[model samples]
Target chain A: MAFDLTLLTGSGFWNPFFWLISIVVALILIYIIYAFGEKGYKRGTQQVKPFISGNPEPSKAGVHVRAGNLYWGYMDALKVYYAGLVPIHSGILTDYLLWLFSVAAILFVLVVLL
Target chain B: MITDFLLHHTPALLVAVPLLGAFLTPIIGRISPIVRKIWVMGTMTLTSAIAVLLVYLVYTRGTFVYVFGALTPGLAIPPDSGGIPIRIIFTVDPMGAFMDLIVAVVGFCVILYSLSGDEKRTGLHYFYTLFLLLITSVLGMVSTGDLFNFFVFIEISSLASAGLVAFSVEQGRAVEAGLKYFMISTMGGIFLLFAIGILYGQYNALNIAMIAERMQFTSLDKIALVLMVVALAMKCGAVPLHFWTPDAYSLAPSTITAMLVVVSQASLYGLFRFVFTLYNLTLNYVTIGWVIIILGVLSMVIGVTMAIPQKDVKRLMAYHAVSQTGYMLLGVGVGLAVLGNQAALDTYGFIAIEGGLFHIINHALYKGLLFLTAGAIIYRIGTRDLNKMGGLGHSMKYTMIFFMIGALAIAGIPPFNGFASKLLIYESVYLFNPLLAIIAMVVSILTLASFVKVFHSIFMGPTLPEYSKVREAPPAMLIGMGILAVLIIAFGFFPQLVVDSLVAPAAHALINQGSYISAILGGA
Candidate 1:
């Protein structure tokens, strides 16, 4: 047996229940588009210069926002995330020893118990 | 089935076909470029087809083993007790076949991609030769019944992968990255050898099943197991040990880089094998699980944070590779933590492990697609800088579409494959520990933000003045991305299919580790 089609798409077309719902959905989509286009037409010609209250929007060209500028607010909120991770230094010999110790402790407990 | 000829030989051929092709490729290449290309594609396709066939056979006939040199089990047909099977073997019992499928599918796509890109100057033939050898080694590592063979295959994969990393000899940074890769991998290899030495001394047997039978969880074995875990962790690019990954991944050609990500994932398979097979933590899972979970959390937090600041898109993806791996570990770790807790194991443990394994498949799909798309961008615009890319959505519309799909998938947005797997992980792990799940959710959101940055910088904004003349990626690259995109959407919508066929078998193999051992030893 191949695909039942009903399970994939819906029940048979004349099943009436879903057919009604489908028509209603299609009508609503068209209505929404029509309503949105009408409103857009009104707004499109209202002669509004780019509204400049105080801070103007940047030019739509050539500005590549760096990570610092992009997340300045968040950066300010979390000032010292690196402090917690500093011990994970790539160059630290002691950090290596600590990792070894932790791994050892965990394995020792597992071997004893399991 | 026992009487069938072809079925009996399929397991051994899975490894042998590619191993033979790896050597045969160079000889064919000397005849003509077309010959080598055709042969390479043919051999990979055949291997992939065989993988599919083997999976089908397993589904039908159950678990099977292929003793090397035709070492028949028992006195007559099936091997009996005390019958010293001197031959090496290939055993496929669900998990091995699944990993084979991953390697073949991903490797095939990568080979197809290499055909599309500009061939490197030095030894294109050797590149494909090593490429096939790498595929063979990965398959062998996943399928070998013997532990020593696993190490041999690892060395093969490591050497071929390093050579591929430095395949572009003109680029000095590629050479440097390859050297770094070799150093770190060799350290991992040494550690692996040390563990093997300890295990061999203890059991006097190298077959995985034989070793598992004799292993008694002694203090020495415990120390060796921990060392093995650490070694495999480094190989898998776990946090704090993942520094070599980003540089090596960024330096290689994108196709090779994508393959390298999957290669690291194979190490996770090794870890899974050890955790479940070598050391069944059905009794004492909490402490071990907590250790893995904590490492996963650290990796999740650190990898994405590092990615956020990376300028090179490949390096950024490489870091995300590390981060996504943390997500997988979180799922598997949560599962491990609650294994013996009957109520927890059935509900949360299974869900978390399944989620993690599902993410493994999903990561290979979207991440592979993303790296390929990044390569497409570089191939077209000739740069890896996210800053220099702007309004690429207009010039490289196809690439943009594919990149957006991959980005959305990786970010764990709903209606994408990433979200489905991640949602499973979140719910299951939340049951295990809500704080861990919340941290995972935060990492998901951060991943979304990072990909959004990528999209805005590369696809939106004005076209860079210099790149106004840039073209879309070649058709073959788009085909590669298109295949992954389809898979991403398909799996997202009908996830139960993947869960049933792929994830269930893999998780089952992990849980039923005894089945793995017994199957290799000619039992179940």
Candidate 2:
């Protein structure tokens, strides 16, 4: 039987054949593009070398970006939120247990009062 | 006849077979490492097959109770006793079968991955033994109908997982992580035991269905509910209480980390069982539901934000595990919020729960794949520092593809399992509250952004001189990851199949508690 999920709503997402056809069509289209595009490609030449703003390529190690520096702006903008969150994940067992207890206490109050 | 026996005794055997394998693993290992490896594989294969059979039996035969050491499965309550199940009971409802399927599938894959990934490690027998025992405990936790039995299983799982976490003695950090995990797990265990004790003291019964039938929702029951939910939320790595999750997940051997993800999901299963079945409609669900929802929102926001800044690849994935867990909580929490109101529940609650439940399986598959891939990178290059990993795509083509599949799946990209479930959550939760759904969408975007950073840092850059000699991961690891990747794609494309076969029956069994109680009481 098909998976209906009618209890959740009238929505159902069960057309495997549709997905199969779509994937086949997409792959064929991509294969056609690649087959046509390969005629202009050159191999084993200076033209194949990576260009960095028309400057000579630096050592790979020097140019490789590290994970720590990848999202500097995002971190800077969320500085205050991180300051609050990062400290709370303090890697201390005592603090972790404390948080567990605090949440329990808060939940207790809420469940009882409401 | 044999099939009948196995079907009748599936629940007990599911737990017992693994426990037996665990005890025999070290003895078998002493004979020969190869023999031990074969034995472990055989054991897990059998266990997984039995789990599948149990799910089939549950779906076809309906809910049933298996009383340990009893004359008959139906003899849960002693004739002398006042309708209380004195013996330990194993309730193989659809929900339990659902969790068993997850534990079995993931546990089998982890064992396959571990065969090669941890081949050279010392005390290999102990590792395999603890792994089997951990699986046993998880199965027990999901299947047991007795609250005290659940507590016992929780303790076993905690100890076994902690041992596995500390397996790499060379890494002092692994030992530290194990210690922290043990301490927090112990605290959670104590709270769990205390809550069980409260219920036992008040109702004089330890069986979940029994106590649920007699639920008074008294002051003590409220306290017990708080303690139980808090402890389980902590165990499952819910936010505000999820500090130990990253440390333990990052430090464990990659295969064990994959299994630990399932371990946490078992805890999540327990949380849902307590909320939906044990408490049912007796408690102030709206209040409890909002509390859970708030915890989920916190976990989602904090987990992804923290993951974005992490330099350690495994640690980043661990935080994402926490974030993915939040989606399950949010989906189920929405269901709980509208529990008693039939109109609201019929309108959106069931879908919300389905979304959460669907996410559970999807998360397990994709997260397990991600950890295995991370392990592969570490196995080849000897480091999890993303900065050090560059141009691995050149050497490890299959690994790159697997990682991409996992990355896209976890990021909720379409044509992946994560997207299917997240769609259900978004569309349904939006009806409940627009703001919640919007936050969920924002979290999904951030998850994608964080993983993009991971992908670019690890695979997209120029080939580094340091990793020039690094080769592809071994075939066994690839096969393990391949299984999960294939399943992820299949589930993504055919979500309706998964929903019909697994999620719907499981969600219905969970939300319908009367059937659970009646299975034991014989419709009394």
* DockQ by candidate, in order: 0.13, 0.52
- TM-scores, all candidates, are 0.87, 0.96
lDDT digits (tens) for residues B203-239 of candidate 2: 9999989899999999999999999999899989999
lDDT of 1 by residue, B1-524 (tens): 64365566777677778888988887888998778778988998888877778887876676667777654521111355354444676766777777877887787777787777645345877888888888888888887777788899889889999998988788898887788778777867887888888888888777777777667877667767777777777777788677777878898989988888888888888887877777775335787787678778978989888787667999899999999999988999988888778788887788889888889889988999899999988888878887667788889998888888889889987567897788888888888889999999999999999898888878886666777888888786777778888889777666666777777887888778678766765443
Worst 10 residues of 2 chain B by lDDT: B515-524
For residues A30-113, write the lDDT of model 1, one tens digit per residue: 998988764434554644435658567555453645333465566556558855654354533344445544654665566554
- Give Cα-based local distance difference scores for all models: 0.77, 0.90
Instruction: Give DockQ: model 2.
Output: 0.52
The candidates' interface RMSDs, in order, read 8.3, 3.3
The list of candidate 2 runs beyond 4 A from truth reads: A3-40, A51-55
- Please name the candidate that would achieve the greatest lDDT relative to the true structure: 2
- lDDT score for residue B431 of model 1: 81
lDDT of 2 by residue, A4-66 (tens): 422223344434455568889999999999888757567987768897898987898888887
